[model samples]
Target: MTWFLISIAALIGGYFIYGTFVEKVFGINEKLATPAHAQNDGVDYVPMSTPKVYLVQLLNIAGVGPIFGPIMGALYGPAALLWIVIGCVFAGAVHDYFSGMLSVRNNGASVPTITGRYLGNGAKHFMNIFAIILLLLVGVVFVSAPAGMLTNLANEQGGLEISKTTMVVAIFAYYIIATIVPVDKIIGRFYPLFGALLIFMSVGLITAVGFSSEHTIMGGYAISDMFTNLNPNDMPLWPALFITIACGAISGFHATQSPLMARCMKNEKNGRFVFYGAMIGEGVIAIIWCTLALSFFGSVDALSDAVHNGGPGNVVYSSSFGLLGTFGGILAFLGVVILPITSGDTAFRSSRLILAEYFNMEQKSLNKRLLMAVPLFVIGAILTQVDFGIIWRYFGFANQSTATIMLWTAAAYLLRHNKLHWICTVPAVFMTTVCIAFIMNNATLGFGLPMTISTTIGIVSALAITAYVVKVSKGKGDTELADEEKPKSAPETV
Candidate 1:
């Protein structure tokens, strides 16, 4: 209970303290015209109020990441609390802010295009393909997870039964339509509704956990207990925890989603509120769910048993029902069902935009959008037949890996401008370490190397990248970095 309360305090306090410092360092200028005003198309690039943009940004990034990831992460003990709080404020929020602000400054270019501008085409091309694949994986995972959940609920209730394949078809169809539609049509308008439900769920869970005497305060591991790995599998806390806990802490995928809102932001000053603020909000949600899982289950062993018996989805449902009853079940439905659908659609939309930006294809028309999306959705649908567990494992590695690349891009942008590059460079180096260690130590991906060997490789990789980035920065004057030309807007593919 004490740790939970302090984690909550950290999120709120970080926004006012560190968030403000970051806002100032990024040098927000309200007077500066954002891409929304500079490049409004009445479609994807229309300006929106800060609040609406904040909601969309929040929902887009939140998905099942904070809820589901942290539930699983809770298995690692109270250490999840440390990572979500500290990681969100320092690493995650910082990553989101730089990525969003960079897009706003660069004509709302996708991360890939921005990477291309700062790094070379080689890096840009790799990121472009990597990001799209990651987004597609996200789309597929979200669709399957929700569809499977709905199927379970139908079976349990014995009403309105639906096959998983049918749910997949319906969800993918929605993704295709959402992808091709303009921003204001489906996503911009309805995202707030979803955002409200998400907030309600977060608040509901937090309230339930706080009020329940049976909640078993400090049920699992305390802060002191966190120093050792309590994971049932003895999963090392280093790479596994960081990678598993990405969204609540920091995710590379947020960089892709930021450009969607970046196109709609009317002023540069709103970037902090929209990007940094949303990440902190997500951290709060993650903390709530993780707390509920730990408190309601009464012990780490109990929580693990619940997870093993019914999976993470069951953890959510049983915890919610156990606390708030029927309404809690509704919240569980929202978290388990609706949240992923919202993110899944946007993932596809972002992919469309990235592809359009990459080929310099204008997205003002439906044909151009569909041309990019049809094949993408088909591939996503095909992926639904494959086991979701495998897809998600790859997705975790890919998601953080993409974030590592974006951090490098952000670091390069800061260096070229001769601004303080350490903010991004340091986190970039750390995540660089995390990604490498996870890749090397995982039995599925690597040779099941010892954590010691993996840690050494991770450290070396991080130091090498840092040295190279610094060396490249030293060779070029600030003017040279600034003079790296931005891409010209592509001709409208009418």
Candidate 2:
């Protein structure tokens, strides 16, 4: 029965969420423009074919979050997957698709740029600062949590000496590859080949594990029982669930991904497939990983043992691939590397866009090596000293706050221009309400809230700014603003 409900929810979510990408919410056809074209620079600004763009965008946005978030969400029982699937389609997918479309229409402007142009300079600067802080936090959490997970994997199966230095070297190698390789060429030629190999390996691993006699299927525990059994000092399901879904459902990073891909999309018609399809792919990955975690761990005690002795990565890898012996373990390790590399690349690209926009650097003229190298090193170094578990917890709340602010900005824009679509508005409202509710609950319960103080402050400031923008916008009247700039036609087909 639970599986049935989950299936239905997934289908519904996938359809609606993916549908938004296909259905142009804003009639964006007229607004698409020829992206400022230049010579192929073999690095950051390499022009990509539509298919290549789609793959890179998909791989970039769908990464470790799908795996880690779902594993964490499983603590609330399989029921949480329902919310993760639904919220992602309605909220996360919408935000990503439209944000990308908006960016593409504006010639690859970041969210803050779009907010600034549509909202105001004050809102733009504020959001930019907020985004940078969020990115750093995300980078810290991203690198450390995954590194810890990798460390765990190494210790258990490979019987290899897993240390911080080795993990750091592996991550550095990934960044170097990402820096020199043109994303277009990589996605166009290498990604398809690698993606196919990854899919086959992932399926084989799942099948091998599933068929193994070593696995056990216990009746899933109730969320209430699960929490009651936990130590009071430990993080609870309610807060953890909120944090887990923050990325899959809503994340500021999506805003960055959306715009860059939107610019490269051959036609606005492809947006639906690339944007929404990628999101659904992410959700599916999350669901699979979470199920693996639950099946492998079996109980909270087992989970704790893995975490305490091996770390979260150990818990994740053992639970995920333990049933399949050596092959499973190797596959799992390789999978971990692939997933994080995709994420790191996306993060690097998004961070570069934000920095370039902030400093008024020509998008095409920016140096990819410096852009990728500096942030990757800085984030990697910062992560080495931090406790990733705590950072992971904070990621949820901070991500929710970032999503909330972005949605609010989008909602205000729609309402102000009287161009509001129910599709976008509904998700915006739903996401905002849920995030705000989660924030309030976490704060009241003294669960340390999922986000940092900086994020909390940013959310509050964004709300105030949004409210003021709306109020001022109302006074100016929609007609005046609408007349200020005419909507352009979509760029002519190549």
Candidate 3:
């Protein structure tokens, strides 16, 4: 109970303490006309209220990552809590903040363009392909989770005869509609309901955990937790926990999602709450799941067994059903289902935006929007046929690797300004090590080296990345404003 309360306090405090420091460092100008006003595309660059954009960003970045990632991470016992708190405040939230604000500064450009601006033309081309591929993978992965869940719920609960294949097609259809429509038409119209369910689900589960006497909250933390590695599976903390935790701590996926909201921000001041605050909100949700995984079953062993038998989806259903009763639990389950659906739609929408920018296609024409979207959906539908397990194996690594690049991008952005660059540089170096070590040590990916060898190589790689970042920083920057680098009448992508 003590650690849980303290952890909650720490997350909220991070918003005020470290979040304030980050905001000041970015130097938000409230009076600056944001793209929503400056560009006024009526599609992607539509002006949204601060609170509205904050909620959109929250639902956009969250998906199942915050819920599923942390539940899996909880398999590591109390060690997971350390990563969520520390990672969110310093690394994840910082990564999100810069991704958003930098977009706002640079005419709401996509990640490939922004990274290319800092990292150079080679990176732009790589990220152009890389970012779109990642989004396609996300769209496909998201489709399977919800469609399967909905099929089961409909058959067992709704008493309606339904098929997973039908649900998949239906979901894809909705994705096409959501991707093509203006932001305000569908997303803006339904988010209030979505937000209510999100609030209900997150708040209900946390309250249940707080009151349940079956296990103490401190059960999730321990004094020896600092020195002991308690993973029952013998997975090391170096890279396994980092990957398992995934976006609960940090993810490159959020870098792709941030620009979606950045284009719609009504004021520069809202960047802190919309981007940084949204990540904090996710950290709190991650904390709740970790604590539930730790305390609900009364021990890490029981929780590990549940995860083994049924996976994180089972943990979510079982815990919600036990704590919140059947009716409330169904709504909670629906909320979990909704999280990914929202993100899945936006993933394609983001891809369309990225492609529009890449080819200089105007989004105002319905024909141009469909021209890009048709091919993207074709690629996504084809990917749905691939073995999901194989695709998922790469998702986590791709997510973290993209995050590593974005952090370095942030570092380069600050370096060009001659501002304090280490805030991002430090995390960039650390994640470079994690990504390198994981790929090197894992049998399925790289050389399958011994941990000792992999860790050494990872550390050496970090030093090299640091030296290169400094070199990139010292190089010349473009002479014009970011907006000037872009077309004056350029509208945002959908």
Taking all chains together, the TM-score of candidate 2 against the true structure is 0.80
Candidate 2 lDDT score at position 29: 56
TM-score of each: 0.95, 0.80, 0.95
Q: lDDT tens string, model 3, 1-494?
A: 76677787999999999999989887776656667878778888888877788888888888888888888887777778888999999999999999998888888898999999888898889888888888898898888878877787787667999988899999999999999999988887787679889989988887887787765665655767734667788778778888777676898889999998888887777888999999999898888888888778876688889988767777887888788887988998898889889999999999999999999999988899999899999999998888766676677888888888999999988887777888899999999999999999999977799999998999999999888878977845455334433444333332
The residue pairs found clashing in candidate 1 are none
Candidate 3 lDDT: 0.84
The CA lDDT of each predicted structure is: 0.83, 0.60, 0.84
lDDT against true structure, model 1: 0.83
For candidate 1, the per-residue lDDT at 387 reads 87
For candidate 3, what is the TM-score? 0.95
In model 3, the number of clashes is: 1
Cα lDDT for residue 471, candidate 2: 70
lDDT by residue for model 2 (87-165), tens: 7777777677767766655666778887776667887888887776666566556566556666766776669888966
TM-score of 1: 0.95
lDDT of 3 at 431: 91
Task: Encode model 1's per-residue lDDT on 376-430: one tens digit a residue.
Answer: 8889888888887798888888989988888888788778767777778888988
